[model samples]
Every structure is written in structure tokens, then in C-alpha cells.
Target chain A: MIDSIKYKIQICCGTMCYIMGGAELHLLNDHLPSNLKDKVSIEGIPCIGKCDTKEKHHPCVKINGEELNNATSQKIVKQLLTLENNDLL
Target chain B: MTYYNNAVITKHELLVRLIQLLDTNKLLDDIDRIPLEMRPRTNSPIRCCVHKDRAVIKYKLMALLGFNIADEQHELTPLKEYAEQALEGYTQNGNFLTVVDEACSSCVQVNYTVSNLCQGCEGRPCQVNCPKDAIMVLNGKANIDHQKCVNCGICQKACPFHAIAYLPVPCEESCPVKAIRKNADGIEEIDFDKCIHCGKCMTACPFGAISEKSQILNLFNNIKHKKEKTVAMVAPAILSQFKASSAQILNSIKAVGFDEVMEVAEGANMTTDHETNELLERLNSGATFMTTSCCPSYIEFSEKHAPELKPFISDTPSPMAYTAMLAKKRFPEHKAVFIGPCLAKRTEVYQNQNIDYVITTEELGAVFAALKFDLVKTDDSPIVSKVVRPESRGYAASGGVTNAIKTILSSEHNITTELIDGIDKKSIRLLRSLPNKKVTDASFYEVMACDGGCINGPVNVSPLKVSQNKLKKAIQEIQSEEAAV
Candidate 1:
């Protein structure tokens, strides 16, 4: 149902992101739902520099255009699942 | 059980980053800043603080450089200088695995604790049953004095409300041989004598305190400085690890500067040829059966725990050693580099005459990532193929050895088979009771230390299903392709 929204999950591979477990999210490429493959794209971007700003989110992974704090394996997968299940795929 | 653990991922991430620096020839100057640069300037760190996280990373970097954590460095030495020293032919000694003391969580030692549910009754069975008077009632609650407590657990049983609960350290629980134990400081220590190097504790530690010393930098130095060509002996278990077809994996391995790629499954084919003949010889002579000794950890386990089964273990060399020997036979001056799943393979390299170095599938992934080479994206340019037989290719899974043996078994004298998937306390007990087993006439035994065989090995980074699919595809591709060599 939410297929119209183009989603891009940007994993921060910056120095800060790597420390906050951003490098670990590289495994997400394997865990992503195949059906949702058409809806989302995964890419590793160098620190968006948002982490060094006043926002204070270091391990943030971007889903669509939204930033997620504490973007660990569990949280990121949960967020992805919600997006997939919301579309009811 | 699921192998996806946070600590394990964190450990691998560190290794990959260290390797990236080494791959680019930037490690000498940039190695010191890696831990600091990765340390977060803002937000939260996984440890207590960014400093603490960096401290752990420092030790991890040391391990990636191939130094045991227990080794003492000079007070005036920089890590870069130490790296230079290591490259200058510093001989390594001490344990295979190391504990970064600063990173250890130092959990409490008490296994059993008295909960608040104790009613403080007049007939305090917990107090009464305490042989050493370790338990006492106070303020309508029960408390155990750890000083007096010998950990007999009589009080735990006597408690009426089931208030006493037992807590175990994860690494200790995961270890089959009870090799990992807490020292006086509560930091886990591995008794090198007792360790089988299965690498369960390395993945089980929540703090990422325990790690195997890496062969990456050493491997890099070997390839860069050595006059001899470096040949990669890729394991059968590696079938599940890479996303590329076997043909592509062959090219991808060469992409990393390897001179040759040898299929370890080809070695497995040889091993099967020998193992099958051995089994027939033994069974025909009225011997009960023989066990497959392809798994180095299984061989160690059988030698240490099941001494009686030592004679029964097939005397065949492992795929890694066998393949390396094959490579050496072809090229007299080539250095054999084994890439596979188990950490025990690292230790196995010590006894190996043909193999020069061994890296896990996890480590290979790190090297690939560091070098920015994607196995799946690599073009299928088949450089060399040994024409691996389909039966030996099946050795990646649990029953692969059984099937390989079945192919050659003479159907002589009603031979039977039993299987042990994973090594744990229960499996060890079963192994002990094998001779006395009355339920089944299972004379022949196949025991794999890691559940589901080498694909499910402790260091294999890929998830079970993903690896399995990739392995199947690679086998099919390899089967169809003809060997140019």
C-alpha cells in the first residue's frame, strides 16, 4: 500500500558510524526482505556529518529520508519489517 | 541456536577495518588513529565511554596485527613501531586466543544467588541445610555469604519458594570442555592446555574481550615480501560463504593477488578415497567402525576426551592439509594459504607441513571488504579449476561424510551409521556412551563439532540459509565447469 514512497536506507560508514555499529549494518543487505527489495535500496555513505552536529545521533541509519537513532541490528530490522508489513507485503 | 550475536559482529567489524588499513598499505602510519578515529566524539558508545571502546579496539587492533594479548610491549614503543618490529621477524609465543583485560566486563562470580522471595521462616531449611553455614536469615530475607559458601547448592535446593537462581557466564556455558574460567580479577582466562580452539568462547563473550589472533597482516606480508607465489586453498565449507559461483570465487581470489586457487573439496575427494578404503579394511577385519576426522576440532576432541576412539578416527589428513599438499606437489615453491570456517584451522596450521597460513571465511570476508572486492559482482572468469567431484563437495553439510562413505561402502556385513551434529555437554555424554549404546546397532559414527558441519562453523559470517543457497549454486557451477589446469 505504501509502495509509492521511494525508500533509501543510507548506512553511515563514517568513522563515528563505524564505532556506533554502523559497519555491522552491512549485514542488512542479506537480511532484507526480497519482496521489499523493489521498494528499498541500501547504500553505505560516509558520515553524512549529521553525527558531528548538535543532533547528537551517531549511529543513525536513514530509512527513506528519516533518521533513526540507535540503528542497531534489532532496531533497523524492526524498522524495515514495519515498513514491509505496513505495505502488507 | 542462532549464531547472530552483537559481540561477534562488533569483533568482525574491527577486524575488517584493521585489514582495510593493511590492504591499502596505510596501516603503518594510520594504525594508531584507527581506534581513536572510530571512537565517537558525541552520542553513546557501546562500552561505558568512547575511551573504553577505543581501549578495546586497541587490543583488537593488536590481535589483528597477530600479537597475543598477553605479550608485553616496551613502555616507549608505539603500536606502529610494534608493527614494524613484528614485520622485522618478531617470533610469536603464548596463547592462540587472548583476553583484553581492559575490555572484560568482570561479571560477578557467584553462580547461585538467594532472591528476595525467601520468607524468613522459623524452620529455615536453607540455613539448616547449609553445610558451611553460608546462608543466613536477616530482615525477613535470606542472604548467602560468598566467603563461607562452597557452592554446594544445598541451600538452592532447600529454599521453599524456589528463590535461588543460578546464573552462568555465557562463554563458560558455550564451552564444551570448560576451558574458559574466571581468574581472580573475574576476567575470563583460557587454559591453553584444555582449549580445543573451537572458537565458541570468542563468539560467546558479550564484551568482545576474547579473540583469535589474526593472520591478515601476516598474510599480507607473505604475499608482498615473499619470493614464492601465494596459493589460496579454498575450503569446501567456503562454498556457503561467498555469494559468487565457484568459478567467480576462483577469479575473485586471484583478484586479491593470489597466484593460484586450489579447491579443498578436491582434497576432500582424495580424503574420501583414503577414508573409504580404511573403513572397508577395518570393517572387513571384524572391527566395529571408523569416524571421519576431517574436522580438526573433532580430531582434537576425540584425542582428548574419547581416547578409546582415537584408534577408530580415520587417519586421513584434513582437506586443508591435503589440498595444500596437492598445491605443493604441483608447485614446489608456492606458499599454501587455507581459507575456511573454523578457528581451529589456525592452530592446525602449526602441525601442517604444506600449509603456510590459514584464514577463516570470516577473515576472508574481511580481506575482501578491506580490498573493496565484491565476490558476487566479480565476473565469472574461470582462471583455474581442479574439477571437484560432487560427493566430496557435499562435505560442507553435516551428513556429507556419510554420503561420501556410503558411495564407497561395500554393503558388506550390514554396516550402520550414527551422527553427532554439534559438540556440547550432551553430545560429549553420548560419545562416552557410544560403545554401550543398546538402542541402535549404530557401529559407524560421524561426528562434526559444529552443527550442520563447516558451513555452520563458528566463524562463518553468513546466515545458514543464505550460505546454504550460495553453496548449492557454487557446487552446480563447479560441476558444470571443466578444469583448465
Candidate 2:
């Protein structure tokens, strides 16, 4: 059943995350390998409120409760590909 | 100017009256009657329509002045030119069209639904619950008949499909300023008088119905001046939006030709320091209570609806104004451009001589896209250790200013403080009622018109709820060292 499949992609649409261009993160869905898109559900939440440092590193999104600090579309795609292959390569 | 008092008309009521008057008078048809000023080659109908609307407004103003539009003339300037110029002058003078729209939207749309749904049961839940008996159930469901409905949306919240729907002009509905309104024809009109030129309506309108006049080409032409120094002061809220590290963001801004990247958060620090002192001074002087003067919209509301409340306004400049002033002082010859999620700052730039231009976050995004800045691709490390107070950064959220002020008061003295954020027009009345002379729990007041504060400012890109959270987290993350600054 489609309902049985539990694939999660957490999207951060928080103010800070958005300033980090989180609104544009939705565009990453197109880059996903089609199989993952259906299995995945993306939800935009208010700020996860992490990355309190001034190092230009925060306003991040969490995928499956694991925080992804460098959350660019490219980094996100690579992370997804790794998830799909089930290999560290 | 002879000012007549009429129960101190709320800005919102004035807006409704203006809209009702236009509808009653069929002003839209007359707006269509005025001709475009452009010779032979005509401008777009939309552009001409705006001019025509201006003409009619001018005619009305003239009538108010007892100078007939047809009769007023001089040798060098024709009546048409005079009218257009006068309308333009009127716009330049205090109009607060956006505030009127906001008040109108909060009142009219809400009043309509409340009026319809109101069931005049013997035991009225709405009336009983209303802190102020602003609601009266006339027929069957709760009818929010005018002079009663405070546009609190409390009744709507209390009601069982979110039935209380407030409608205003599309731009007005969308505008953070509440500047746009509908004429008799259902066409949207701007109160250039009240517009701070934040351009939120331009993005909010699905129909592309509202727009700001483009100064891009003018900017490009001015860019030819090799000796001219152009500086872009970015808001701290932008830290979360860009792809690069903080330092890289600065570098990227430099790459875009800005001489230096200064954080508006620094200005926030200055404002916090000054505002704290001002609040303390007010308390010490026995000035029963005071309200923050940071948000331009809040300031505008006080000017219109509660002029008596003006004495309570803090004299401290807003972060944007403070930052621009400092920037102008640092690089006296440089042109300063402030970029943020505020539509009202456009008016700030014109009103204050320290700044040259104001661009919204969306406009800044466009600038990035146009420049083809591959932000994600860049590996530049961002400058991470910029010192700004955590409390100051929290100023991005609603009631944030009050919280920051309260923190200062608590740290320095034993005086009590009270904070009210995310309050609309109705709540202001409640707050006004709470102010007592002798003894009160809260001595200081912090109220933001928009719920969730500046981050949720009408011009912001992120949703209000989301922005509020992000700001909360951001504040949590602020280092104690940084918070001190």
C-alpha cells in the first residue's frame, strides 16, 4: 500500500531558513530521482531555530530528524542519491 | 489649517467612509473621463487610469478647498497641470492611504461577515465575550454592525469554517500598509498618500495588479559614475536567506558592487541602547506609560487614530534609520541603499535624507538572479562573529522590542514593564483603556501592529508563522557575548 511507505523529506520554511533561500528549496523536488519523489513527503515548518552561531552556517533543515547543516539544493540532492543507493559512495 | 473634531475618527473608519463615498458618488466613471497627459502616443490604459484617478482626487481636494477645478488656473500652468501637480503634492504631504486601507480592511470585510452570521440570540456569546461590546447580534447569527465590530477577528475565531472573512481591495488586503482600495468599478486604487512604497502589494497580487515604478534603469545610468561609492546596508534577517556563509554573503554583496556590507542588526543594537534609555527616562519622569516608536506603520496609526497617544511615543530612531544615519556619517560621500522585508521603508528613504534607495527582500532576490550570482557554488567562508545583541536580533519578531526593553529595565532598575505584541486596531483600544494613573502592574508598553513583528512584516517573503519561529530560534542561538553588544 502507498500508505505503508514511509519516506520523509523535512523542509524548513522558517524565516531564517527562507532567508537562506529555503523558499527556493522546493525547486529541489524536480532534481530528485522520480522514484524518491512519490515516496517522499516534504513539509515546511517554522524555524527549527538551530545554528545560533554567526558563522553563516545555520537556518538549516532536518531530514528524517537528522539535521542537515549545509542544506543547498546540490547538497540535498547528493544526500538523497546516497539514501537511494544505500551505499556510502 | 482648521481641524474639525468628529469623535476622533479612526483611520479605519475614514477608509470605509472614503470607499463608501466613492461607491455612492460613482467616482470610478468620472476617473475614466479624465484624459492622459502623454502627447499623440498614448500610455497604457492602466497608467492613464491611475492618472485619471489622481485627477479626480485632485478635483475633490480642490472642492474641499472651495477652489473649483475648472475655475483655478495661472498663465504658466494650466488647470490640468495644476490639478496633477496638486494631487502629486497631496501625495507628498501626509496621506497615510495604506493605514486607511488596513483599518478599512480590518473593519469592512470583517463587519460584512459578522453582520451576516450574527444571530441575535437573547444570550449573545460574542457580546459577552467581547472585552468591548463591539459586537451585537442583530438578526439571527452574530451581525457585526458598524460602530460595533472592532475587526478583532475574535468572533470569527470563536465561530465554528472560519466564517468571519474580512475583504478589502486586493492590494489593500495584501498590502502591509493597507494602502490599496477598490473604487465603484471594483478596480483597485492606491492611496499614494499612505504608501510607504514597500511594494508588498506588487508581490502579493496574483493579478500583477500593483507595482512600484522601476528605478533600475535610472540606477544603471547612475552606475556610470566610477567615483561614486554605493553602499548596501542589509537587514540581519537576510542572514538566513542567502546560500553563502555570512562572510561570503558580505563578499557576494561586495561582488555586486557595494563598497561595504553593514548589518542593520548593528543599528538595532544602537536603537536598543537608546530606546532603553528613553523608556527609563520616561518612567523616571513619571510619564505614566510609553509605546515603542520603531515600526513605521505603528507610528502612522498613532498619528491618525490616536494623536493624543503621540506624547507616549519613544523618541529613538528605528534600526533602519539609525543604520542609514550611521552609514551616511561613515562614508559621507557614499550613497546608502537599505535592503529588507519592509515595504514602508520606501517612504523612509524619501522622508529621511540619510538613505538613497530602499529595496524589498524580493527585489534583492531579483538583483541576485539578474547578476547570476552562483551563491551555492561559492565556497567562501562567511564572517561569523559580527557582534549584535540577541535581544536586538529578537527585535525582528513581534513584541520583541518590548521584551528587549523589559530586559533592559529589569537589569537596570526595579520598575515594572508590560508587553503586548501582534495587536491590531481593536486591541489598541483595549490597551488604551488599561492605562491608569495611580498604580499599574506594567509601566512600559511594546505593541507591534503586525502579529509576529518585523519578520512577519507585510512585505516579508516567509509566512508570518514561519518567520516567527525562525526568529525565535535565531534569538535562542545568540551567544551571551553577542547579546551584550
Measured against the true two-chain complex, the DockQ scores of the candidates, in the order shown, are 0.12, 0.06
| Docking verdict class for candidate 1 | incorrect
Report the Cα lDDT for residue B26, model 1: 82
TM-score of every model versus the real structure = 0.83, 0.56
Candidate 2 residue lDDT tens string, B1-485: 00111111111111222222232343233322222221113434322455543343334333322233334565233334433333222323322222211112222333336535444656566667776577655446565565666667666666553556665444555454455666553456676655544444554453333333323322322342344587778876654444344455556666766776677877888888898888788888888777787777667656655667788788999988988888888888888878776655555666888887665554454444434454544446534336667777777776667766666666548656666665444566656565444665576777665555667554444545445555555555556435555
Error of 1 at B364 (Å): 1.1
Candidate 1: which pairs clash?
A: none
Best by DockQ: 1
Q: Number of clashes in model 2?
A: 31
The segments of candidate 1 whose C-alpha lies over 4 angstroms from its true place after superposition are A1-89, B41-45, B73-76, B88-95, B114-129, B138-140, B154-163, B225-227, B410-413, B435-440, B479-485
Instruction: Report the poorest 10 consecutive residues by lDDT, candidate 1 chain B.
Output: B86-95
Give Cα-based local distance difference scores for all models: 0.73, 0.54
lDDT of 1 by residue, B45-127 (tens): 88778888887878776765667656645533557876776554345443468777777787657778977777888879989
